[model samples]
Target: MTYWNQEIETMDPVRLRGLQSERLVKLVHYVYEKSPFYKKLFDEKGIKPEDIKSIGDIQKLPFTYKKDLRDTYPTGMFCVKNTDLVRIHASSGTTGKPIVVGYTQNDITNWAESLARGFTSVGLGKDDILQISYGYGLFTGGLGAHYGSERIGATTIPISSGNTERQLSLMEDLNVTAVLCTPSYFSYLIEVAEKEGRSLKNNKSLRVGIFGAEPWSESLRHRIEERSGIKAYDVFGTSELSGPLFTECPEQNGMHVWADMFIVEILNPETLEPVKDGETGELVVTTLLKEALPLIRYRVGDLASIENTVCACGRTHPRLMRLTGRSDDMTIVRGINVFPGQVESVLMKIPEVSPHFLMMIERNGELDDMTVQVELNDLASDKVEDYNRLISRISHDLRTVLTLSVDVELVNPGTIPRSEGKAKRVIDKRKF
Candidate 1:
């Protein structure tokens, strides 16, 4: 089979583990020496760099939380100075402050190579014309995929999300062979094409889809493939993990996690201990090769399992099974990460609205829709015009924080049910 970096991708399992162990040994010392955050954390936990001599000793290290990133803010967690960084990307800050990550030149090159391996695994190469539809700027998806496509010597069209008509036009005119985008956006494209009397199923050039940025199911995969006439492959990564890292092979099985760069563990969310192989748990990752912002045992919060058995595609790297859900309450809508706390933060800023609110998510056709059901304060005005103004204002504020438009429904003070224990803030109706 055609491969990218075959030497590492198909390395023997015993040798791969040895490589990971060796890297782990160096990474512990590197982070402890370079990053004040890691040093302080290790010191506080009464652990030393020498304690992590092998991959098996990873459990001895403390886990890094999403809150830790917020606590560090912009560059406190970075190992390299600003001048040494080649690129910077941040999370949406749905919880609090956005988690910022930086990359050195070598880090960017490794990131590109990681994705190039993914693209080449699916038969895309120099001759393919790739259309990247992920959003650019601040977020990592667009540029991450762009660099990888170029690294593979493919002709890339950096569409950078939105402008549906133009996107479809270029797909036809440029003879685009592959598309990189969220599954929801791709579904919307199909709907737009159908309304314009165009048929993606009949398109001659499009052959492959690289879809990620949100959890999707096999049923959605089948639907996307049927409508777009392309084999849909799931690409998984977070901006913290060098964005868009792993992808499914031609067999269309679970996504292969590059063992040489990352050491992934499926651990019990409650106990923080490893789960038996093939059993679902929280995904914890330690970066073996990341330079600017190497993370050790960072809790990714996604719920998934790993298959230790070799993939049918002949890659030795373990495959991450379909992600079941997130360990936290974060939700993704139209590819943007959202948390209930962000909505609450906006609500608290408005005098007319109370904190008692419910967020509902549903799938309308192929698109995911969000509705914020909020209660008005006791002293709020009852006039229709005033309520309209309030709704408009609240919707705008929420969109600013979430980066996605949500329908806001202002209800009476006592309309929403009161809870004596923990409050229920979200009601998700989507099946996947």
Candidate 2:
């Protein structure tokens, strides 16, 4: 029941909405006056800053997307002058120009504060030691978690990703109590630890793992916790929303979205209308506190739902349910929508298979075909008939989940590439 900012975290619902409304008003005005992007967008939509006096008017404001940021590369959307910015972070730009995000002093503070709240919710405090296993530099996961860990007065390790030996070594020697990294990397760490004749399950110091930066499943969470002997909590946020913002409280249910900092909306992807609470939809967020690069009604592209009822831990903020996957990460095969997370969930439940998997999609003639490459754990039988039966079982289970039959390929252990960061789950060979 411990909280970083108990007052803000446990604020009354009506008062929380009022606070959000107040911030939304100021944010609208600030962006309208300072950012050319917002000004032009508002003008083009025939919407004025005054029109958005409350959070309910958020629907009137036009939606923003990652494409908007990409279309206006390198600070075209920035609200402040270069001198006001203290730091900059950008994506890999794998598809186009990297999204350049600037941070003012206040922006950095708020970013750390957001994550600090999350870290504390997971039982991390001043007395804990935190090992940051995320990659440093352009990626936000590293430095973002670093400042947050320090903000909580936790002894912080800036040992960026890669070098499995060193990560495990420092983790053990330093008695690291918490770890921040992509869930896939942690799974690899667990595998490597097992191969090295060491068990993370035996580590007395490590108790909590906060994993995100990619979509995972509740099944994976259960598997990870069972194997590593630590409470695995899902952390939620994107590079666009200031990175590693919210995490599941020790209740281990859903991530609590700070109401005063941001206004979150879960909308139906097709209709662009708010979904009923507890129903899955696209996550749209408006950052009320971002100074250098505030986004309004920005389509975060992740598919999830919100639980507005106060959590068992007594926090009043909305909880972001498990994300199925990003909108872009989804693929349509035979007119059925498929997400990597759905595939992961199905694979993780199979006791004979490892958590590592890759989904391959191809087109033959007029039809689309999907083949899932699953890695076999040591428990799987080596007999050809047993392997065939295992594949049949997996295919049946996948069909039950995805509603589509898929060719299942069971590969030997270590056959799939291990990721030190986000795990690649899809290989679509179909054009258009």
Best by lDDT: 2
32-67 per-residue lDDT for model 1 (tens digits)? 999999999999999999988888898899989877
TM-score of 2: 0.98
Provide the overall lDDT of each model, using Cα atoms, as 2-decimal numbers.
0.86, 0.91
The segments of candidate 2 whose C-alpha lies over 4 angstroms from its true place after superposition are: 94-96
lDDT against true structure, model 1: 0.86
lDDT of 2 by residue, 1-432 (tens): 788999999999999999999999999999999988999999999999889878888899999999999889878889999999999999755345679888999999998988888888888999999999998998889999999999999999999999999999999999999999999999999999988988899999999999998889999998899889999999987888887888899888899999999999999989999999999999999999999999999998788999999999989999998888888889999999999899889888888888899999999999999999999988898999999999888999999999998999889999999999889889999998
lDDT, residue 366, model 1: 88
Worst 10 residues of 2 by lDDT: 89-98
Which residue pairs show collisions in model 1?
none
